[model samples]
Target chain A: MAHLGLRRFPPPLMVLLFLATAAGKEEYGGGSGGLRFRREGGTFKVLQVADMHFGDGRSTPCEDVLPAQQRGCSDLNTTAFLYRVLRAEDPDLVVFTGDNIYGADSSDAAKSMDAAIAPAIAMKLPWAAVLGNHDQEGTLSRESVMRHLVGMKNSLSGLNPEGIKIDGYGNYNLEVGGVEGTLLANKSVLNLYFLDSGDYSTVWWIPGYGWIKASQQAWFRQTSSDLQKRYTTEEPTQKEPAPGLVYFHIPVPEFGSFTASSFTGVKQEGISSPSINSGFFTTMLESGDVKAAFIGHDHINDFCGKLSGIQLCYDGGFGYHAYGKAGWSWRARVVSVQLEKAESGEWRGVKSIKTWKRLDDQHLTTIDSEVLWNRGSNEPQPI
Target chain B: MAHLGLRRFPPPLMVLLFLATAAGKEEYGGGSGGLRFRREGGTFKVLQVADMHFGDGRSTPCEDVLPAQQRGCSDLNTTAFLYRVLRAEDPDLVVFTGDNIYGADSSDAAKSMDAAIAPAIAMKLPWAAVLGNHDQEGTLSRESVMRHLVGMKNSLSGLNPEGIKIDGYGNYNLEVGGVEGTLLANKSVLNLYFLDSGDYSTVWWIPGYGWIKASQQAWFRQTSSDLQKRYTTEEPTQKEPAPGLVYFHIPVPEFGSFTASSFTGVKQEGISSPSINSGFFTTMLESGDVKAAFIGHDHINDFCGKLSGIQLCYDGGFGYHAYGKAGWSWRARVVSVQLEKAESGEWRGVKSIKTWKRLDDQHLTTIDSEVLWNRGSNEPQPI
Candidate 1:
């Protein structure tokens, strides 16, 4: 009798086989709002890689390193850089703040997204993303692009069962709660907001890039209100306000308002034109929950400032395919929220969160490190 | 058979007896954040009675409607006004923003608190409170006063297990999620923040009134952050920011920043002195979750305005004992949040929330009706 493909291996070998198959799988569950990472020593670390532009190297083999004249990247170098950043920071979460692939109508968004984030997926790093202006500029609509990128193995970027109800792609929220026994029970200390700032202006006469529409703003406000109400208790004596950060593709017009002199970091390129003062900045200000708004459109202009009490920031582009100034290296932004015992004698929530840039290289050197917000300070910044 | 002074009456009478005894028992559980009033077709109605100074009527009788010169109140009138408001609006939730009782060393805090909110409690109304400056100025410390009011029948005010860690009295958060087919099996939609803005400041330099301390500010920031992080899903795709409103005893310094002319409706008194700029307003602005701040310190001033993007509001004082201008009416703030289907096509949260003044008389007429934050408008207020 011929043996069927199914064979009864020893229990130990069977377990190893199951493990191997599971390891080969590429998609992870897009969690309910309750997904939590193991809180290491009370802190959850996040690394953000913006504007990967992976498709620029899609046609070239991994061994070929594109020269400066090519105005593109070496896929191998990009992957190596990601590996270095991951090993150096070992962040609990990784965020691709858009432009994971160059929008070539011929390029496959799914393939490019996979190639761009393959290292992270293999490492089983939890990750998320928002779309860049260039993402949907090709044959694929933003929704189609999102479909290709969402719900991959170990990936956290997809329209899910628990996402905010919105028309746009990649509009969602995530939470990181403290470890049990380390912090207050049922409390989430850090929140991350990923929004879709559209590619092209569809609203007629707005001009230039697409803006965050009123519908998206409404979704943000509504979802935000729900989260605050859920985690906070209305017990007559202890009111907690949740703090969060926002990530997106295009910068709000407020970014242009921050002068080079007002900033603390390197500014190798001029700030790109932003969406016409869409009330997104005002919405952020009004919600009173977002501490910093991070963006990726102005990849070469890696600088941040306190604009009306919100830190409007930019992370230098992570892909060589993206434009960069001479002497500037590919870099990523590393944001660390301090989870500690607050003044009220509870190891419950974060009081201070800081951000810095990590050079996407072998050394993984950091620069422009600064406190984003300090709970003890009276002023929004240290002044 | 000596009945031990208790006799078994008819079955119905026995049931009544049990209920009567049960009514007097204290320590109702502060909700675990899932408590929601039946959303009357997608509306969460709240009746907020500000500054109800219900004393024991010890110095005077219930009939004495303390003349303008007198600084105390009539217990009977206060109860009657509450009854009238409740009968007219039939609100889902009642909030005694502050000064529910006039603290008198001779007056029992528990009795006064009960008497003031008795009508709502007897009606089985879900109610909450924040202590006013006068709430602790008498025989009882604020802590002692809180102990009396903490656990009462059908009460939503107490040092709850779900509360943020803080050193103050009456600082908690509440949520009202949409009932999924009449049961709360899903997430919360609306969040209400109840904060204790402290009595007199022990911070020697700041004389006169107390202020929101760094500790409380820190707590607010931390808790707000925690809430946002908890409800927002980080699955690489959907990041929802939570929106919320805040309630407290004294107003922050930012209240004074709004000019008398910029306000609408009633300003019977100069905006009462607010806490010295202790950066609470700055904190709210920085956190980006709180849309409006409701306050009750100034019994005579009942106006709200957009000051630096956050609404600083006051609900006209409710107590007859509290100082009111001649011809000024006793009123409460009626806040309602719209629990409609969001753009995301789900009733997962609230988009627009509005607040208006509800007269405490039988008429229950609304004045100062305004859109606190509309879902469709570009501006927070009606343009």
Candidate 2:
């Protein structure tokens, strides 16, 4: 399944932990480095792994499985699936869209967090994540969990934006740039946003999942505006805003907009969105910068559907420690490309973007491929 | 139960209604005049009648009643209850907080609308309303229902804030001024906001009860800010925003934040709020002008509790056509006094606000009276 020849590292070599540089990433609170297009095709592939729910390694038993498969099955099986997918796809970046660890099942949240992202760390692929509803349930506070994630090797997660007050930790943005040292080297062609959807309802009256607060919405609006300003300022002729891909744990209420027939993949369960419609969808629509938002909370829902021009998708539950449909193979949604527009047709902004999913089966079954957006004449569907 | 001597108009005279002046108020789209505190004690008493669920006269039968009481129990019983409460309380202003008529049951919405508000119209008391989920179910759309209400005699409801783009109709505000002809005759002593908490979810995905949208919240915030600016401009020494009393149909999600012990009255049914939060409560909290919010969707809930700082209360099941407990009496919540602050000794701005409830039984039972807010040192509770 691995296509790229020299660039795609072999699974044997990828699994071995690559020693990190002696230079400290201690002050790297995300967005300082490590996000660029592939040298061969200029493709920036993003693999979204949701709800890993990793726990005490082999001690944790996989839930909702057949009696025969449950013998020695544990969180290690989840790790195996992750490595399998990574080996097959060899993505540029991996985004863990929440519920990275089942905090309730772990005695040490730091270890669980580390173990959950170990596959990405070992592969030395830059990864960013947003904490979900169950992520703060273990021995760590939400702040501690986020801090642990921010310090991990090859991690690009931050403890909220630099000076602003956003609700939960890990609310930050990563700028995926064009090729290094060229005219578009420092310029961001694509932006990836990671926002924590929160642990639980802290508001006594609103008993359920905690929602993205008004403050978070305000922060998003400001960030969106700031990004558009910088993008337009640099290239005055290209007034369009840079395309964005947002990652969060919980789905906004708008996720329920799709019917089974209208969407691409399956919706095995209800979308466990917050009871409160915090108006983030409206903000996104107004911003006109975000192209798609990927989330994970409802484990069985793996569909991708466009609502009011923006795509809302899910990463079908990835961890064996978490409850899943018996025979359903855990899967990952892969965004294959974000083409960088080059000067004078040599190939500079985002040119085209596409996405699909890959199952954890032996063949690494690919399905539900679709074009999210295109700047050229090759757009498959009407946006 | 009647407190004032000569100022309290007799029930019989009140019902006669001095035939509305030939000078047609056909053009009165609210805020053209008429909202002033009574001269006797300078108190602005407001009667909240919720969920009248009126239908085509005597043919409509009541629901959830004992076998004996079921015999001649129809919407007329609800009408009788309204009249009984009105006669006993003799309120200065009446506000119908949604579900004024069961649109599904009514063959003629206009006739039903007239019948539902007949008590207030007949008594010639100034009345305003915010439609509920059931108001547009039968013969007309939400706009038609509100248009009819705005045209009714003695009705103060408007078809939304002037020239604004609020979601539903009947989104408007009323200003209760100081006694006529005085130096403070034009000053707004109290601000009453009447917003239509829509009939159903128009945003396809978020299905349930209709919610107050971001647009409406923005309208409310702007109106609040404008009111504050005017108040401060008029009285530079008084930096405080005008005390606001908001009236709507469905409660915001915050209504569920209270326990039985924390609030007064009974919550017999689940809080029938919209699934989406919409952040109206947060906007109100930030505005600092709203002293209390009165809503009516959940028929059996008559509880009044404070969440954060704002008071959220229900008007009980006032309509026979709607569902209710067999033993519980139909009732109305009353805001008895909005004390006008005096310059030297006599009254001027809103100094204190108090609320209570009255049943439709033979004694016209009054219950759960408390001080909502008081500017003077006389405030009972901490908030």
Predictions in order: lDDT: 0.65, 0.75
lDDT of 2 at A48: 95
DockQ of the two-chain complex in candidate 2: 0.06
- Model 2 Cα displacement at B64 (Å)? 42
Regions of model 1 farther than 4 Å from truth? A1-39, A56-73, A160-165, A183-185, A234-238, A273-275, A342-346, A378-383, B1-383
Flag regions of model 2 displaced more than 4 Å.
A1-32, A235-237, A340-345, A376-383, B1-383
Model 1 TM-score, all chains together:
0.46
**lDDT over C-alpha atoms for residue A54 of model 1:** 76
Q: How many residue pairs clash in each candidate?
A: 53, 7
Which candidate leads in TM-score? 2
The true-versus-predicted C-alpha distance at residue A349 of model 2, in Å, is 1.5
Over A1-383, each residue of candidate 2 has an lDDT whose tens digit, in order, gives: 11011112343432231111112212211123557776567788999999999888899999887788889999999999999999888998899998999999998999998888999999988888889888888999888888888888878777766554446787877776665533444456678777877777654445577777655665666667666776676432255677888999998988998888888899999888766556677656555678888999888999998875678888889999998998888889999765655555432667777888888777989998988777644222222
